[model samples]
Target chain A: MAELARLQADFAAAILGPDADVGGLGGRVEGDGIPAPLRLNVYRNNFRQGLGTALAEIFPVVQAFVGPAFLKAALRHFVVAYPPSEPMLYGYGAGFADFLDHFPPAAQVPYVADVARVEWAMHELQNAVEEGVLTTSALPEAGRVRLSGNVRLVVSRYPVASLWMAGTGQLPPEAVNPDAGGQTAAIVLSDMEIRLLPLEGGIKTLAETLWRDEEPDAAQLVHLPALAGRGMLTDGETQA
Target chain B: MPILKRTEASAGTEIGVGLKSQHYQDVVATSPALSFFEVHAENYMMKGGAHRRWLDAVSDRYALSLHGVGMSLGSVEGLDTAHVRRFRSLVDAYDPWLISEHLAWSRTGGTYLNDLLPLPLTTETFEILVANVSTLQDAIGRQVLVENPSAYLSFVDSHIPEVDFLAGLAERTGCGLLLDVNNVFVSASNMGWDARAYLDAVPASAVGEIHLAGHALKEVNGLPLRIDDHGSAVSEEVWDLFRHLIRRVGPRPTLVEWDTDIPALPILLAEAEKAAVILAGETGRRKAAHG
Candidate 1:
């Protein structure tokens, strides 16, 4: 009904901008030290609170980087652009990193997006299917049948791995300057956890094909991977 | 939806604890002396995966209750029949011992605040709930219990007292009441009303489950505004209210709900055990007094 929408709009307006004419909500406008404005302020606070908590949950690393105040301001911007469309609050906040990329404020911090991407990957990885991966023994005796919710990965950049390591306290406080970096490799969320290693292109292809039920006619790492490949890590010898 | 059929005189069922995922192995191993496990219906609403996997694992061992926080039962708009259908499917799949929702509404039109929002207790609103509950119950093909809310503010236009409103709801829709005692204390204290009187007003016979939790006090302009925050241990006053309530209503299924700032599993178990002690004491007293 028009009345309900008006009430919601008023409530929203009162939340976003208290000076706006927020009218016709069921609760009172005054008399108990509670202005309609203050009531709406509480709602605004809750709105911010919900999103803020959710973002912190999803990107604790990013939150650490930006700190609470910056994150809070970023979230205020996000909520205006991306109010939740569904009741399920857990699965929200997919657009923050991209939003940051275009955001003029974060222009100085260009690599924030890359860092956010890492955090988002970790977030997604947490919720990803935790099926059993290929065992070490299974690696030798296997036809590449595609591993279950599992794969091995290799990143060309050790700095990404070191950055992750530095963030996670796996490595010491050796600040990984991405500019002054040796090429890094990672396992990349393989083994159901983020692992960084030299990019192994062939075995990952075999795994991906197997995972997707595609048995490509190749016993070796046929992808001609740049840094690392999974299939038959022989010493630079091409298969006959 | 309101309950399709409920026996007011029916004996209260066994107590249940909210199922947390971490305790799956411990619960399976220990088989602790719990009456049942209540889970957020939405949590296990997934089709397959760990939520379903463990729920299936534990389903054989315990009675399950489906308590939903998202079904905006008191919304002015008609119930989301899709939600009702999903609930019905879950009910069919899980076959829970009891199903319940809040007296509060969350979604209005299409947007969802996802908080258990307060509703004005009035004749018009009653009509809305009656229709919504009836429709939801019909869709779900089962009965439902409605829990009372923790209200922060009162509406001047609202003529009906919350107790009467809730009791009236149960009467009209054939629903059971999940009497949240801490909510009662908080709402009563915040609004400056008599909680004992409100408890007396709510017919004891209509209640199916009892909920107790801690609250935080917010002094909004020196008026003690008790926020129904289940973050810490049960307050002495809330415990006192609980003792008073169960003594009157007899030993019903009670839960010590600690949602925010959830402590370790053992700490939660200890809190539940504390409630059990009170329940045991009351049970002993009743036997001595009545028998």
Candidate 2:
């Protein structure tokens, strides 16, 4: 058992570590016509390509914003730094946004991390379980309401929603200005489609309050019907 | 958890395709005439979403096979209890006709490599696999089939052959075997073993399912190596190997696996059709032999 564990550790290190150190582990593999290092490269390519492709799927908008080459380089570092702790690939890359925040190459593009956050939020909401819609009639006149399980609110300093839309080709690239100021976007699943609605003023406050699970004031309640109509708000009742 | 018995009506000996998310709407709408659809257990591990909805719709119209990729049955550290629970939940919800996982390890030291990493065919690794497979079977309350992995390199310390290792694992755990002919062909070619001889040696009754897929050939250090990419159609060599196995073991529930560069739905169904034809011929041959 100890020997097997050591071999696995060495093999994993040879794959995830820098390419210069494969010789040590390669000696353990049989070179039946093909060199041991070349055989180990197969696993190296598979490991990087598999996780790289998964990150590309999860953060396509980021790929669009930073281009594939830059995303690939960043992914090269992100994967080793934050290899998946679980088997579910969809749940992976939750820490990518934070990784990009500290990435030196991405320092020039200050809004890319926020863009990653928005993309990750969309990814999570898309996979979130569908919940019963909160009908307008079910709302109590003066009671607490909560955001649905499938709703995500990403408040960013930059125009994150416009950036997302532009990256998705919904809006032209020229339509978004990174310095165009702060934006609060509500990502919700309604009518079987994930919609990103940029919020402002009392509506944004109402969403922020509900997302935090706090009671909304009378002024904020004015937008309650709007949120309920979009199936974004739910009564505070726990689901069975 | 209620145990769903594998009745003959539900476990038909027909060919199926691996269900991809890209063809969910097409599959649900067209309802193609395939025996069963195989899905990666990790892909549908979510609590709810469009994936579940599409899978529910497709499973409603056809039989399902739960093919897991990340269980890491050969991990020396032992099985992940949380992953087993998720797998059990999926089994209970779908009540699939067949359930299987790879005889490889992907997770180690709490880091999942996201690829079916190879394991050395030794007694130590074999014991680990016995324990893990038994744990999974006990948790799901059903027998699980362990599939062979495509190998690129062999371990220097390994003394046992790959076929004997898998056969021993099945014998000890009482699990079935999923004979991936493409894997067999690739491993045999890469390791300089006789692919047909390997098939001839497989214990026939333990093979509950078979997989046919494509592989890509690349030259490493001027030596030819076959990589099990599963990006294209099944090669003629793999088809010949599949025929050889079916001729020996009769018909099993076969699946056309195309994981990378997935083509259109019709293209996948066409591959499944090819397997179905071969399976039909094998069935006729078996009937004649029995009579």
DockQ of every model listed?
0.23, 0.80
Which portions of model 2 show Cα errors greater than 4 Å?
A23-26, A133-137, A212-223, A238-240, B1-12, B289-291
lDDT of 1 by residue, B110-219 (tens): 66665676665678778888888778777777778889988766665568889998899888887778899999988787677798888878887778888877888876
What 10-residue stretch in candidate 1 chain A is worst by lDDT? Answer: A231-240
Model 2 lDDT tens row, B1-291: 332335334333678899999999899889999978999999999888788889999999888999999999988999899999999999999999899999899888988988888888888888999999989988998779899999998888888898899899878888888899999999999999999999998898788889999999998889899999999999999888887788788888999999899999999999999898888887778779888
Question: Chain A of candidate 1: what's the TM-score?
Answer: 0.63
Native contacts kept (model 1): 0.16
Give me candidate 2's TM-score against the actual structure. Answer: 0.95
| Model 1 lDDT per residue over A71-190, tens place | 778877876566665555545677787888787877765555555666665555454444443333434343434433323322322345556566666666456665554332323444
Query: On a 0 to 1 DockQ scale, where is model 1?
Result: 0.23
Evaluate all candidate structures by whole-model CA lDDT and list the values in order.
Answer: 0.66, 0.87
